[model samples]
Target: MRLITCSNSAPAYPAPTDTVLRTGAAGGLVPHLLALLRDGGDWLFPVRGRDEPRWPDRIGPVRLRPVPVDETDRRAHYETISVELLLWLFHYLHDTVAEPAFDARLGRAWAAYRRVNAAVADRVPAAADPDALVLVNDYHLMLVPGMLSGRPRVVYAHQVPWCEPDYFGLLPAAVRREILGSLLACHSVVFHSTRWADAFVRCCERYLPGVTRTGETIEHPGGRTRVVAVPLPVDAAAVRALTTADRTGAWRTELDRMADGRRALVRVDRLDLWKNHLRGFAAYDELLRRRPGLADDVWLLAVVARPRHRTPRHLAYESACRAAVARLNETWRRPKGPDPVTLLDATDPADTRHRAIAALSTADVVLINPTYDGFNLVAKEAALASETSRILLSRTAGAHDYLAPLVTSLDPCDVDATATAMQAALDRPVALPDPPSARRLRTAIGADTSADWLAAVLGTPRTGTAGRDVHPTN
Candidate 1:
């Protein structure tokens, strides 16, 4: 089975040893696919928008070269112009249907979308093999499936296609129809959760006009669209192995020394608005405000955010978070002692791992409050590794649906409610689960590793989960 996975960025980049770029999305998926290919499967990895210093003639002995889309600026202009214009028109039209509060800067979004599409079109071919099964990923490559004459294509939506009413309400009906028609014409559609899947179908009908639902609707489409909610999985065993390393005892000791036998409230997130990091901090701040003595007893450790793109909004948000942390530290000071909340730089991977494991080991509470998330893999990872009490979870996160029982659920939008949950997490007396129970949870999660998800999606025999087992390389 020659399985191919393509994306906007490569799994790894060849940067100078000293000057390293922070690993982001591309860092997340490419490694899993490469690992699987090395183990047993035959795989083809092709990423667009890459400039290698030494252009490889082949990847793992497979002939490799960029596939050109058009002669005129590599079709980038046409592709970008088409998609960005469509996005704005669709967002304007769908705003009333999805939600009135959905606010995305459409003009800014359009500009970014145009740049992304241009890059994608520069890489994808003008025409592709209709017989080769194509698994297109994200909105950046939305036009790829449409370009193929009669291919068995599968689209995996990472975000709500027509999300945020204020944003998606701009697109005209005709453009939306063509986009949905192009996507629905595919053999299958995959979403991270049922909520987004349902929203996607609604967008199709509201904008596509004549589109109708057929068969048992996972989501209602104007035509025969097969939608499935296949949640993404993490590499649980590797996570545990990394966290449970015996050689990292010195780092653990230093972290433990900092803890001073107090309850540790930890959150690991990029400084993004959608992550609700400020709200999470406010919750911890509230916990300290109400129980003055507990402020001295508990420490909130946040991983500092990396410098993202040179966007004004991104810079502004990062500054706001830094200010908030500083204010909290000033407001709740330890009498003649160190700061209550410690903010570590995001680039410190070794420390991040050590602190994450130590937090899981010593946590009285692990808080993950996202404004909206397809699913928070960290929640599951923390839960599996946790030797303490229930996690403080945000209801908007997809993992909330699955791990509700093990979490102290609250609205991510409400700071007060989150504050209350944080207090509850600190005050409530619940005994830690025995080793056997913790082991069982870890086992269940390990069964659904990234390898399992890939195998099932590719129609290969998966490890378990019925006969959906794919062949795993040794």
Candidate 2:
């Protein structure tokens, strides 16, 4: 089958099969999928941006059709729709929309969003093979599957969390209708977990009349969309290479030296509202206060991945997190011991991936406390980073249930509970990778794997040659 993929932004790095995917925010997806698709097959991932035209259409067999839009419309589309509307729609942030020309801006956003998708829809027919599988990723292009004509198998993959019908109802009826209706047009609607998959099914049942959900499949007038939770895996080999002692040994060595031979806890995340960085800091602070002696032992190495465009919220979050760190250091920093809290947001993020992995490699615990994340790959990568490091994960995280059995779970918002769990994880016995449980984790995380994810999304049985991935635990 001919494989075609579409995403809101281009891959962060040069993507699969010698494809030079110009820089954009594709969420490090290219590498994960690159590792997955081991067998040979034709694939295309159409992308759009103001600078997209400079890149060629085809890099070897992988076609990157540039669907460029006007500059002004692109800005309005990216700022309002992709960043604001979709993130707000998912309730990633609790703040109310506060911007000039809110409704009018939303109108422009919707128009630009549609324009990008329509341009992409126009490109599909040229590359459409007899049996084509067009995989649409992210909330940015929910309308693409519906806009495209028949013959190409469409799979709409929602990488983020799906809101409940009541919260989704908050959107204007027309907006919510378009979102659900277009998503229902796909051959499959994939999510990171059964939690979000079930939410999508429920929303379809609530909003779209006559839509029936049988097991994991949603049937509507358009067709059946198999709703499955296929969590994407971390690029384990790449992470291991990054953490190699020769490349970044100083990171862990320094962390241990600073911690005065005690525990070093590393929390690496994009400095975003949804990441709950503030709460994580507060929990750590509380833990230190509760057990002052522990402060000399446990240290927090916050390696935040700063965004390219720092919004007001991002700046404010950075400010607040810094203040908390300063306060923690003032209270707990021992002259001869750990610094108490160190926030590393000033470094070049392009080069920090290896450093973060290196730091986590020597950590006693890794904290991933997202308030409500669709799927936090950092948690998976952290687990892969160390055999002895205990992971303290958020219960609301999409990977929580799958990982909870293996890692310590905590409520993201509960400061007291999080602090308790942090201490517990610090004390938890280090279970070396062994037996049925560890085997399941390794399988779920794309360890020693191939392209079963592609097959699963395409509704085809996994061939013997293809490797493994997380199947629906529900």
- Provide backbone clash counts, one per model: 27, 0
lDDT of each: 0.56, 0.71
- The candidate maximizing TM-score is 2
Cα lDDT tens digits for candidate 2, 1-474:
556777655545444455543334323565654443333233333444556656655654566556667776666666677777677568456344543234775786788878877777776755436576777778877888788756447888777788778777667777778888888787788887888888888988988888998887778887777888776656666776777756477766666666667778889888887888889989998998888898877889888877655778778988888898898888888886557888876365455776778777878889999888888878777777777888888877887755765577788889999999898887776765545776566555644333666666665646422132243332
Give each model a TM-score. 0.77, 0.89
lDDT of 2 at 410: 81
- Model 1 local distance difference test score: 0.56
Work out candidate 2's RMSD over C-alphas: 3.4
- Residue ranges of candidate 1 with Cα displaced over 4 Å: 14-27, 35-53, 58-132, 157-167, 172-175, 214-223, 246-250, 348-358, 430-441, 455-474
Write down the lDDT that model 2 would get: 0.71
* Candidate 1: tens digits of C-alpha lDDT, residues 1-474: 333434443434433442222233412344445554443322222333334324344444332333332233323333333333432232232234653221354434444444444454344333344344445565555654454435454444453223543344445444455456667766667655555565677776666655666532434343355665556666666666756787335556766777777667887666655677788888888777778888788888775455333245457877888888899989988778667887766455435555555555556678898877666677776776665655888776766655555677778878888888888777777674545644554565667766666555554636644122111110
Q: Which candidate achieves the best lDDT against the true structure?
A: 2
| Candidate 2, poorest ten consecutive residues by summed lDDT | 465-474
Report model 2's TM-score to 2 decimal places. 0.89
